[model samples]
Every structure is written in structure tokens, then in C-alpha cells.
Target: MTAFLLRKLGWAAATMLTVSILVYLALEVNVDDVAAKVLGQFSTGEQREAWLLANGYRDPLVLRYGRWLVAFLSGDWGLSSHFRAPVIEIIPARLGASLLLGACALLVMVPTALLLGVIAGMRPNSVMDRVVSVFAILSTSVPDFASAVLLSAIFVFWLGVLPGTSTMLTGFSLSELVLPVAVLALYSTGYLARITRTAMAEVMASHYVRTARLKGAGTFRIVFRHALRNALIVPATVVMMQVPWLLSGVIVVEVFFAYKGFGSLLYDAALNSDIYLIEACAMVSVVVVVLSQILSDLAYVWLNPRISLSGAERSAGVTDA
Candidate 1:
């Protein structure tokens, strides 16, 4: 397990480094334009040249990338042109807001999805199965934006109980968080439920389940001890894998609900062409995605410990020894 984690972390680092290089090269496309955009069109040629020289655009690509990478490692993520603040300072607040929202969504979504799926899979062809399947399909079929709009119309316009925007200007507010979290949870639940349902159904049909039944095991024991544990392996990994999807979904949901999260911040940076902010956001996103996959792999192994042996261990001929 230690080896696995060390390997995954190394890959995550490499992925971030590669993404950084790509981001830097993309920004290097038109140094003159970046300077002009940052300094406004009315700035003189000397101003652009001065900006380029100051930012190390005049240096070799290798040196510039090395400096940028070192600075990024040292927590200097550059300055945001739009916010007129340090990129490091701006990103953490937005990222924290997003993480809070995501944590809430996951708390609500995961158990609900697993319960619905397990209930449906317990009796695959029964009336309950059909009902849960239909619900899952309908929920997953609708996009996040549409869900947000529909939810807002119902909660904000018809009921008038909850706030439409999830802006955390002062601090956290449960009422404001309702619609955004609901939208994210509802959008993802259907797909995850389907996965769990399939896994549960397969486990319920496996020979071990039959053997448990033949050995006079109670329905509860067969379901919980024998079946549910194996069924969770796939769903657990998938649940961890949803982090990136949730982040992507946040872009639409955050914008629609006026939530100042990492996704919406990225949107703002792109619209304003804040290259520094964009780079920071991109790097952060890559890190999140790679880290999520690592978590997924860890979950998979945790659920099935027999496969925890690394290739190096497997090749050592321990069985003969």
C-alpha cells in the first residue's frame, strides 16, 4: 500500500508538471498581446517591452519555465490581472468554497444513491426496481443547468422559501446552499445509483450468495455480510471518481446560482483573460483530477486487499520461498 501511494503521488506530480508546461506554452503564444491586454491598448510600445522584460518573457523558455515552476512550488502563483490580487490568495478562498459545497453534496448524494441502488438491485425485476430505475434515469438524463433552473423556479419563484443565490459573502448559510447542493446531488445521483445497482445485482447472483443461502444463512446475513461488501468495491471507487465531475458541474451550477466558487472564478478569469488566474485555476484543476484518481485507486485496493501487492512484490516468487 505504501508503494502504491508513493507511485501514485509521483504520477500526480508528473501530471501537474506536464500541465504546467502546457499552460506556460499556451500563455507564451503571444507575449505582446498578453502585455497589451494586461496594460491596455493605450499603453506605449516601451510599456509592453518593459512588461515583457519584467516578467521574464525576454528570457529563454527553459529558464522561464524553471523559474515559474520553482515559484509555483514556493506558493507564488503569480497575480490575478482581473482581481488585482495575488493568485495564491484569491484561489484558496474560492477553492475552499467549492470544497464546502462539494462536501455537502457528497454527504447527501452518496448514501442516497447507494440505498436507492441497493433497494432496486435486491429484487431486480420487482416493482421497486422499476420505480428506482425510472427515477435514476430521469435524474441523470437532465443536465445540471436545467436542474438548477427548474429547482430555482420551484424553490425561489413558487415556494419562495430559499434564496436563489448561494453567495457566501459574509459566511456560510444553509438556506443559500440548498439549491446548489441539491442541483449537484440530483444531477450525479442517477448515474452513481445505476452503477451501484448493477454491482449489487451481480453480487446477489454470485455463487457465494447461493452457497450462503444453501447453508441456511438468513436473508439479512446473506445480503449484508456476503453480498453488500463485494458490491461496494466498484461503487466506492466510482464515488471517489466523481470529484472531477462535481467540479465540472460546479461551473454551470455556480454561475447559475451566483456562487463565487472555484469554477465560477475560473469562468471569470477566462472572460477577463486573466492569464495568471487562468494558469493557477488550470493547475489546480489538474491537481484535483489526478488526486481524485489516486483516491479512487486507493479505495479500490481498500475494498479488495488481496490485490494490494505491487508488481514488484508479485515478481519476487514469495510463494516458492
Candidate 2:
């Protein structure tokens, strides 16, 4: 367990380093006249040159990246070119909003999806299964923006029950979150449900389930106690994999709703060419992806300890060989 965790963490760190380098290079190569943009368009040549030197843009690419990486590790994410504030200082509130929305959406998504999926899976090819499949397909097919618009029109314009925009609310409220959460949940719920249904259906069909039934186990006992545990591995991983998708999707949802979450913040930074802000956001996103995957792996091991135990035994055998 210790070795496995250490290895995963090491790989995650390496992945982050690689991602940071690529993000930096991509932004640097694509963005033209960055120093001038940071300084101002009308700034004099000397001022631009001075700013570049001061910020180490004049340094070699490797040196600049190294410095940036070191500084990022040291909790200095640099100043936001657009906001003129440190990137670290700017992220928390926006991150909080994004997390709030994401959490609420997941809370709504997971159990509902799993229950629907279990029902469908247990009765594959039945009317309930077909209906669940259709709903999942329809939900996945709709783009986030279109869904946001449709939802806003219905709930906000037609019914006038929910707020149209989630912009700049001083504090959190479930009423304010209803539209955005629904939109986000709608997209992810479909994918998660489909995966869960497939996994659960396969588990239900397996020999052990038949054996349990032959042993006089009740339908509920076999489905819940036997099938559900093994079925969870794939669906859990699928849910974890959605972290990046959810993060990216939030940009459109938040922008459409005028929500000032991290996604909206990212959109603003990209629009204004806020290089430091972009870098910080990208780094944080990569970190989230890494951590989520690690957690997912741990969950899998917890669900099926034999997997990790076998893995460790294999490692030991290889070491001995």
C-alpha cells in the first residue's frame, strides 16, 4: 500500500510538471506581445523591455519556466496581468463558488443516476431500461450552453421561479444555484447512468448472482449485497473521470448564467490574456485531475481488495525475479 501510494504520488507530480511545461509553452508561443499586453498597448518600447526583464521574460525559456515552477511551488503564482492582484489571492472565492456548484451537482447526480441505472440494469430490455437509456442519451446529446439556455427560458422566463443569472450573489443560496446545478448535473448524470447501467447489468448476469439466487437468496439481497459492490468499480471510476469534464463544462454554464465561479474567472482571464491567472488555473485543474484519479484508484481497491493484493504480490514476484 505504501509503495503503491508513493508510486502514484510520484507519477502525479511528474504529470503535473509535464502539464505545466506544456501549458507555459503553449501560452507563450500562441500569445503575441505578452509584455506589451501586460504593460499596456500604448506603453513605450523601453517600458515593455523593462517589464520583460523585470519579470524574467528576457530569460531563456528553460530558466523562465524553472523560475515559474519554483515560484508556483513556493505559493507565489505571480500577479494577474488583468486584475493586478496575486493569482493566489484571486482564486479562493471563485474556486469556492465553482466547488459549491460542482458539489451540489454531484450530490444530485450520483445517487439518482445509480438508482435509475440499477433499475434499468436489473431489467435489461424491459420498458424501464429503454426509457432510462433514452433519457440518458438525450441528456448526453444536448450541449451545456443549449441546455442552459433552454433551462433559463423555461424556469426563469416562462415560470419566473428561478433566477436567470447567478452573477455576483453576495452569499450562497440553493434558490440561486438551482439552474446552474441542474444544467451541470444533467450532462454528467447521463454519462454516469449509462456506465452504471452497463456495469450493473453485467454483474447481474454473472454466475455468482445466479449461484446466489440458486442458494435461495432474495432478489433484493442478491442485487444489493452481491451485484452492487462489484458493479460499483467501473461506475466509480467513470464518475471520477468526469472531474475534468465538469470543470471544463462549468465555464460555459457559469458564463451563460453570469456566475462568477472559477470557470467564469478562467473565461475572463483567457479573454483578457491574463497569463499568470491562466497558468494558475491550469495548474490547479491538473492537480484536481491527478488527485481525483488517485482517489478513484483507492476507492477501487477498497471495493475489491483482491485487486491491490494481487497487484502487490505481482510486484513482489517481479522484484524477486
Candidate 3:
């Protein structure tokens, strides 16, 4: 376990380094006169040149990348030109908000998807299964933005029961979160449900389940105690992989709902050419993606003791020899 974690952590660092370099280069190539933009156009040529030199923007690309990487490692993410504040200061609250929203959506999505999937899988080809399959297909087919708009219109405009925008001044309230959460839940629930249903159905058809049935195991015990544990292996990984998507791919929903979260911050930063903020957001996304995969791997290992770690696999081979 220790060796596996160390190896994963090493890979994570390498991944982050590569991502940071690519993001930095992409921004540097696309945005001309970054120093002028950062120092302001009204500043004289000498001022811009001096600012660029002082910031090492005048250095070679490799040197500049190394400088930025070092600073990033030391928790100095640089200043946000958009907000006239440090990137560190601006991002934490936005990140927290995005995480909170994602958590709220997941809280609603997971159980609902699992319950519907279990029912459908256990009664394959029946009315309940067909209905769930249809709902899953329909929900997944709809674009997230369209789903957000439709939900917002129905709840905020037509019914007038919920707020149209999620922007909150005195922190968040359940009422303010209803439409946004509903949109996210609806968008993500379908994919999770489909995966769960497929896994559960496959597990239910396996020989062990047949043996259990032949052994006169109760339906509930066979399904819950035996099938569900193995079925969850795939779905657990699927759910973990959604973390990066929820963090970075919710831009449309955030913009539509006026939610002040990481997605919105990234959108605004890119639009305004806030290079530091954009880089920071990209790093956050990369980190989340890598970490979530690692987490998923760990969860799979924990859920199935029969699964061998790299070290353990080598040990088993030696023992066999």
C-alpha cells in the first residue's frame, strides 16, 4: 500500500508539471503583450518593459515556466488581473462554492440513481426496468445547458417559487440552491443510473448469484448482500471520475444561474485574459482529475480484497515460483 501510494503521488506530480507547462504555453501563445495587459496599456513602453523584466516575462519560456512552477509549488498562484487580488484569495471561496454545489447535487443523485438502477436491474425487461431505461436515456440525451434553462424557466419563471439566479449575498440558502441543484442532479443522475443498472444487471446474472438462488438464499439477501457489493465496484469508479467534470464542466450552469463558483471564475478569467487566474483554475482542474482517479483506484482496492496491488502481485508470483 505504501509503495502504491508513493508511485501514484510521483505520477501525480509529473502530471501536474506537464499540465502546468501546457497551460502556461497555451495562454502565453494566445495572449499577446501579456506584460502590457498586466501592467496596463496606458503605461509607457519603458514601464511595460521593466515590468516584464521584473516578472521574468522577458526570460526564455522554459525559465518562465520553471519560475511559475516554483511559485505555484510554494502556494503563490500570482495576482488575478480580473479581480485585482491574489489568485489564492479569489479562488478558495469560488472553489468551495463549486465543491458545495457538486456535493449537494451528488447527494441527491447517488441514492436516487442507485435505487432506480437496483429496481430496474432486479426486474430486468419488466415495466420498471423499461421506464427507468427510458428516463435515463432521455436525461442523458439532453444538453446540460438546455436542462438548466428548462428547469430554471419552469421553477423560476413559470412557477415563481424559486429564485432565478443563484447569486447569494448572505451565504447560500436551500431555496436559492433548488434550481441549480436540480439541473445538476438531473444532468448527472442519468449516466450514473445507467452505469449502475448495467453493472447490477451483470452481477445479478453471474454464476454466484445463480448458486445463491439455488441455495435458497432470500431474494433480498441475494440482491443486497451478494450482488450489490460487487456491482458497486464499477459505479464507484464512475462516480469518482465525475469529480473533475463537476468541478470544471459546470460553466454553463454557473453562468446561467449566476452562480459564483470555480466554473464561473474560469470563464470570466479567460474572457478577460486573466492569465494567472486562468492558469490557477487549469491547475485545479488537473489536480482534481488526477486525485479523483487515484481515489477511485484506492476505493476499488478497498472494496475488493481479491484485487492485488503491484507489490502484492509480485509477492504472489514469487510465492508461486
TM-score of each: 0.94, 0.93, 0.93
Local accuracy by lDDT, each model: 0.86, 0.86, 0.83
Q: By the lDDT metric, which is better: model 1 or model 3?
A: 1
User: Model 1, 8-119: lDDT tens per residue?
Assistant: 7898888898889999999855789889878777899999999999888888878888998899889998878888999999998899999999999999999999999898
Instruction: Give per-residue CA lDDT, model 2, range 27-47, as digits (tens).
Output: 765323877667778888888
Report how far residue 245 has shifted in candidate 1, in Å.
0.7
TM-score of 1: 0.94
In each prediction, how many residue pairs overlap at the backbone (N, C-alpha, C within less than 3 A)?
0, 0, 0
| Clashing pairs for predicted structure model 2, backbone only | none
Lowest summed lDDT over 10 consecutive residues: which window, candidate 3? 311-320
Report the lDDT of model 1 for residue 110.
Answer: 98
